[model samples]
Target: MDSYEKLSYVSITPHAEFLRNFVANTICHSCKTSQRKRCINMADDHNLCSECYKTAVFSIERLPYIVHNLRKFYRQFNLKVDKNIPIFLTDKVEMRKEFDDKTTHSMTVYAKKSTTLVIKNCLWQGEKMEAVKEPKKLSKISILLRFGYPDVITGARLAHEMMNVWLGNKGCMDIQQNIKEGICKVMAYKWLDWYFCNYVDSSSDNGRLGLRYIQIYKPEIESNRAFRGAKMAVDKYGLKHTLKHIVNTRNLPDVNQATALVKIMNEPNEINTVLLAQEEMVEQRTSRKMGLIFS
Candidate 1:
């Protein structure tokens, strides 16, 4: 499967087992010490102590607020899409099968026509009554996330999936998979950074835990080649310019080209000269190719 199909995270299994065997001799993935009395093994193959487990599970009720915050955060970058996109939480078994058990955290699926039930309100004798459902076909984009994770992880995953939605809305869905995933990862990383800096308070225990996880995960994201390249582009050229180039050309600009463009912009007098020279070279190449074909 293409890497873009799903977002994967570093599994705590190996680290947990290593700590259990050598370091702290504890089965718990979090709080590696053996002091906790009870440890529960989760379906995803990580053992969390009672106290840690309580905070590890995310609540579905908070999903709407996360989505709302993401939409608000995206506005600063001028990324906008439908206010409502169906997001569902699924079991580890289903997610594992879909991602071939690569430790996937989330996936976004696009459909041309999806069957959905629409309710029609019915009234009898001017009183509110039952509602009837009818199957309706609609184009939609849906996000499926694994059932359990901390709030920070869920927010980051949703932010990544929402970037896919934005791409589809901007008609840039056909771009190369690496570029697409790279941009999405960048957005997710940005969201994490924003969350840590603005929302999280390091004074509290829960806030500190969230910040720690964000620190661990952000580095993993930076390790991916696509993500690294995109981040470099964004850092050097700015997000607005980099995104605009991607949308216009359907490709990431090479370092040399980006540098030259920046130089051309910085030096106003050289803009026409640089552009005309580049255009002339292209014309000459085209003429030469045509002559060779005719000959």
Candidate 2:
């Protein structure tokens, strides 16, 4: 790209022609332009002069853009997300709208029978139990990683789930019946951050933007790419025997494996328990004529 086309941090080429045509519109009678008032994108209010707008456009719009983008301006920044992770996205079927009958209520009510995971508490539970709650410090991303991406759920599922949740009651809203859904939503949002956004440069800062663009564009991955790459490295040099030696095993269900684990549990403080002293010489010195005391 040439210098002329290079993206500038500031400076906007106003659409004077568009604004003029719009201002001339019969519906725009109340606009500041009708009173010979200048309207700059930087203005706090539409009535402000172009000279005053010199500093307002970039800074003020940051907050309002975030708001408007989610609402009426969805089409402006509605990103194309890719499904790379095995994340799932589903919408509610408006069965309730069709019937106000009992069957509709029964189907809509997702909360089914609840079952206890532990029927018999452990010996530790025999004592008085304290209020058990989740650690509040765990963010959504941390929670998803802790859960380690549930079965058949991928990053793609996460991205869409996040979008749905973020929109709240709008745009394909539905009840998330599973705890993993909550996890997936959080993962989806973070995943979205990485997929969306157009960064100006390839540097780390802009690299972040580029990544955000990707997350927004492509949400799911079919494989754990880094892990797959590592697996490929395993066959790089036909070092199968080397890995076997490192593992140190005979056949299945080896007793040595258990013994090795136990030894590891109570590790030695010092290596090779050996002393230079001779038992015979020490016994000779300590023996007070006590049965020759020799080994």
Candidate 3:
């Protein structure tokens, strides 16, 4: 029987003894060597040796890319990736979406013999149990070492952004799930930032005449901050009105004011106090620059 077909005969066993025995007996999906205590359970009933598992963990955020590139790297020398090795992933699926459904419904896993895992808790219905401790952040040093120069800097920047999003989500400590959710959130934020920038940048000259340019060119602004600023201005200033209403309005806020509005929205209490103290200084500086105030 084929290896995949052999997996069908394997029962879903949650007994710790079974996990140990399985590891001891199975040939590593990577090296095809029966290395005792060196196997880890992977998706779709496969197991990888410690060395192969470490490689996968190192490529966590960019697993698919790394796998593809690995083949390409070897192909340059006219070789193929070893076919005997197992691919742990059965299907490419969004991690967050899959886990979100499980979490939301409080679904618990129970080891079944073949297809599904099922457990009956009827006998211990009233038993008390200790709460599960939250998971901690996973280290990425191995992954970081793989990058060089600008790639390292870029990776650090994105990782920072992803951490912010993850924290904002009150992320669970589960390392794999956290990373997946963070990646999804970062991608969404980037799309929105790009959308807004392109929409504003591509508008006609009349629409781009003044302060809007500042928003278009705001360097290194977080997408969430930009979004909050736009939202605040729209809600507070009735920016939803017709273009005629906007054009006829007097003392309309310029782009700098809009960005300041964003900052205030994001850090309301702290920014309010700080802005009050700095307002006079900023005004004086502006006046001097415009030659309205002599030095």
With a 3 Å backbone cut-off (N, CA, C), the pairs that clash in candidate 1 are: none
Estimate, for each residue in 1-295, the C-alpha lDDT of model 2 and write its tens digit: 4222332322224333224322222221112233354332211112223322221222212223322332321222233322221111111122222224422111211122322111111011111111111212221221011011111122334343433333332322243333223322333333333223221233454343334334333332214342232223222211122122223432111223345433543454232111112222332433432233223
TM-score winner among the candidates?
1
lDDT of 1 by residue, 166-279 (tens): 888888989999999898998888888767655766667777676666767788798999998888787666566577778888987776667755864456455445543543
Better of 1 and 3 by lDDT: 1
Indicate whether candidate 1 or candidate 3 has the larger TM-score. 1
Instruction: Name the regions of candidate 3 deviating beyond 4 angstroms.
Output: 1-22, 34-37, 57-60, 64-295
Candidate 2, residue 33: CA error in Å? 52
TM-score of 1: 0.66
lDDT of 3 at 219: 30
Candidates in descending lDDT order = 1, 3, 2
In model 3, the clashing pairs are none
Candidate 2 — what's its lDDT? 0.26
- Relative to the true structure, how large is the alpha-carbon lDDT of every model? 0.63, 0.26, 0.30
**lDDT for predicted candidate 3 compared with the true structure:** 0.30
Question: How many angstroms is residue 145 displaced in model 1 relative to the true structure, after the best TM-score fit?
Answer: 0.8
